[model samples]
Target chain A: MKTASPFLELEAAPARATVWFDGEPLDLPQGANLAAALLAAGVAVFRHTPASGAPRGPFCLMGACFDCLVEIDGVVRQACMLEVEDGLRVTRPHEAEDSGAPV
Target chain B: MRQCDVIVVGAGPAGMAAAATAADAGLQVALLDEQPRAGGQIYRDVDRVAALRGGILGKDYTEGRALTAAIRRDGIEHLDGAVVWAIEDGFCVSYTRAGQAAQVSAPKVILATGALERPMPLPGWTLPGVMTAGAGQILLKQSGLLARRAVLVGTGPLLYLIAAQMVRAGTPPVALVETQTRADLMRANRHLGGALRGWPYLAKGLAMLAELMRARVPRYTGATTIAIAGDGRAEAVTFRSGGKPRTVACDTVFLHHGVVPNTQAARSVGVPHRWDAAQHCFNPVVDAWGGTAVAGVFLAGDGAGIGGAKVAETAGRIAALKVAEELGRLSADERDRRAAPLNRLRSRQTAIRPFLDAAYPPFAEALAPADATLVCRCEEVTAGEIRGYAKLGCIGPNQTKAFGRAGMGPCQGRYCGLTVTALLAEATGQTPDQTGYYRIRPPLKPVTLGELAAMDDGARDAAE
Candidate 1:
């Protein structure tokens, strides 16, 4: 069943791809814009700032602002610039650091 | 490494036209874009979006289909998903594609890098659900996603365009909180003649406004002290409209003042820039043909200045003609003959700019946000800190790096450069030009150490 979301997807995708966001699996539209797909899937916060630990999401979907920075394959990249691919593991950058996890 | 006669960085209207024009003149051209498709932000995924939701974004967007199709001709190589990080001396361009670094060099380079939404730094602007109106449009264009109960804020044609688009998508914004006032329109009255010459653009704006009104989307004009209030996400927008405080509840807040040239790539290449007082941003100093002081380097489109997409396309053609002449592909006489019409069209297209700039000038508060507002999102630097730096004898953006690491973050001051300059200028009572901008360095986009090392290895292998 499609989950209730504040964001609505206007088009139906040909397929669904399961991508993990911070270890939670989300079945997003295959090959859809990653940031949009995540938002439609009810994942609002993409990362938390290292300074004040404030939540940040994609502000400029065109890749100007770095607010949408997410850790993928151990590298931080803009989620807005990426596409939703099946089995892609994405995590919020600075989450461990902000949570006082070991460096 | 790949070699071409001309290389165009960005696949937007300017870059597309440049590549297509140069290629049509028998010059080898490679067009590089950050997106996975040819359409730059203006036409982001135009081919797909137009096919799926025809006319939802309106004719202005779908019209880009012709330009996007123009690049399909022979001799034009389109490289997508390429994040150009550097334009080194000798016109060598370095970009990363699919986690691998690549190099493409050319005798001439056209930086048609396009524009970025002028940063609107209000309180709670960094909240999770607060995004630029351009972002909202991109969501609709790229993924056909629309925010539920969103409120469009700020002043500009783009804000209205997005509101109309949302209404077309059956999800009209709850309201529009506009900051432009009658005084702004009065200030813009002097440019009415020129704006009249650009009647099509004026007509489009009026039509979009009419569409919003017909949809009954309440619009609050002459709003001030606008701020987003939320716990961790945007819950509502608060502002003073017509001398009365009002709060509009919404899940999303789309903010936009206007767009300015995305000059980071051009600046990275050491091209000189000057403050555009009318547009209130720094733009590259370029000739009519888009040639800069940097030899063999040219710029076109919004990256040169904030002329819209149509102006950018004409500028691209004019620049390509000049570049072709420089490369001996066309005679000076032929280049001039070909460029004359384009130059005229570009001027006509840009006629609406002065009026638009004066009428919907960037919100005054956003130009220099409150002391507590976060100016530098990456460094989490506050506007107060920037002012403090100015007080401590900090002259320009570079010095802020040492004082508080303002422009040293991943974005490299793309978002906060103008605000920092404005803050420093206000605090020190210096002009924005005197206050100056960040010395943009490459890699322009963030690249991993592994990618850089691998790039070096790739270069060495190519040499061997």
Candidate 2:
């Protein structure tokens, strides 16, 4: 299956760092917002809702909606609220595993 | 125990304007925001995004460049990445930044917290790929991205704006589904005279509509029974348009139903708010100058109500001028004279609000979804479950929360509070105002024990 990406860099900005999403390495633009970077890499399913086990993605990427919860370096954070850095590890939180606090 | 003359929460148009105005008036101002940058959501990354993608986002976005630049200028202490979790009555704000707990105190505080998309609790809204249109716009604004194929749903000027933005980005939605009825548009026409006074806004909306028409994206109006359908993730949308059922195949479904002020901070601080019948939501009560009943605490911009960027910026300036005058920094005469023009601009900006509100009132059926639909995504509580509790004689949102864990989740009822009130109001014979909103508990947002420990440690350090 091919990964689907809805994002494309409009300008030819050079890649500055790489971040790992679900163990897949993706190069990202320097200072790029993490949520945008993940979406660009075709990783849309940020995590599954704990209550219903339904897959959920980022909504209201400004952190108003908590739908973009993901675990980064063992701490849960809103991907949209964070910036991409080199060598950062991102993972989806599983059921019964609490993501970090409310955004 | 740090003190400043003024502390502004939120860095959007209102907060930025407030901070800059107060600072320029020779007051010590601390501007705090959750994002690393100062531009609030409307102007998110205005400094960088405008320079990069200004042509696509349009003039209103690019206009934010001035506000962001002013926030970056001197006289204001800008603290980015600070998540304010609590606002105490004595004008103290407790927050966490970089895993450290701290507090900032001031004689006056401005909550320019901005707005959030009104919750549209629908079947499959909890599913992946079913996101808000604003979220999609943020992707494009932040990284220049759009869904490969998305079906934009719901109504209001924002709906058309985002669709037009997508068309400009060379990735227009595969389809556009509008839930607004012809009657709604007719009712809006009654406000035409007032809207005509704000010709610029009317023109902008018309331009966006024209762009969509020129693109010839499949358009559906008076949409009903709208549901996102997929096995687990959204892959198709089913709705009835013009009394005929239709389906659009798409990977993503973008939904928007206008916006509502973010009243959590104000409500937390015991600032009284009232239900706005015309707008169909509760708004923090503020005087003409954005002064809350709680002296020294104020709400400006959309957080006060659903005024757009122009009104928010002007309102912010007015609030700051009042703050400065109250704090003895600016004389009352100077404040009123400086505010005259901004107030006039605000009147012009909001002139068309009545028309927009009548045209795109809350989709009550959509907001109050079917029984089986998930009302609280965090707690996974269904509307059926909430209604069941209401049948058992739950009178209010707080009572409903106690009966079922609907509003106890991490979001702290940001998404579900309105929906819960609406559902309960429908189930019971009570108005939404009578049912009231959640009685918010402290730690308004989730905070770690470590962060609390740091607060004590920081206090000890200050004592030393």
- Which candidate has the highest lDDT of all? 1
Interface RMSD of each: 0.8, 1.6
Specify the highest-DockQ model's number: 1
| Candidate 1 Cα errors over 4 Å, as ranges | A1-4, A96-102, B456-458, B462-464
Error of 1 at B320 (Å): 0.5
Question: What lDDT score goes with residue B325 in model 2?
Answer: 98
Q: Return the TM-score for candidate 1, rounded to 2 decimals.
A: 0.97
Candidate DockQ values, in order, are 0.83, 0.63
Q: Across residues B1-464, which tens digit of lDDT does each residue of candidate 1 receive?
A: 78899999999999999999999899999999999998798888998888788769877889889999999988999999999988998888999988888899998999999999898999999998899988898888889888988999999999988999999989999999999999999999999999999999999999999999999999999999999999888899999998899999998999999999999988888899999888899989999999999999999999999888898999999999999999999999999999888878877888998899999989999998999999999989999999999889998889989999998887889899999999999998999889889998888888887876677565768667
List residue ranges in candidate 2 displaced over 4 A: A94-103, B455-458, B461-464
Please give, for every candidate in the order listed, the TM-score of chain B alone compared with the true chain B: 0.98, 0.97
DockQ of 1: 0.83
Q: Deviation in angstroms for B417 in model 2?
A: 0.8
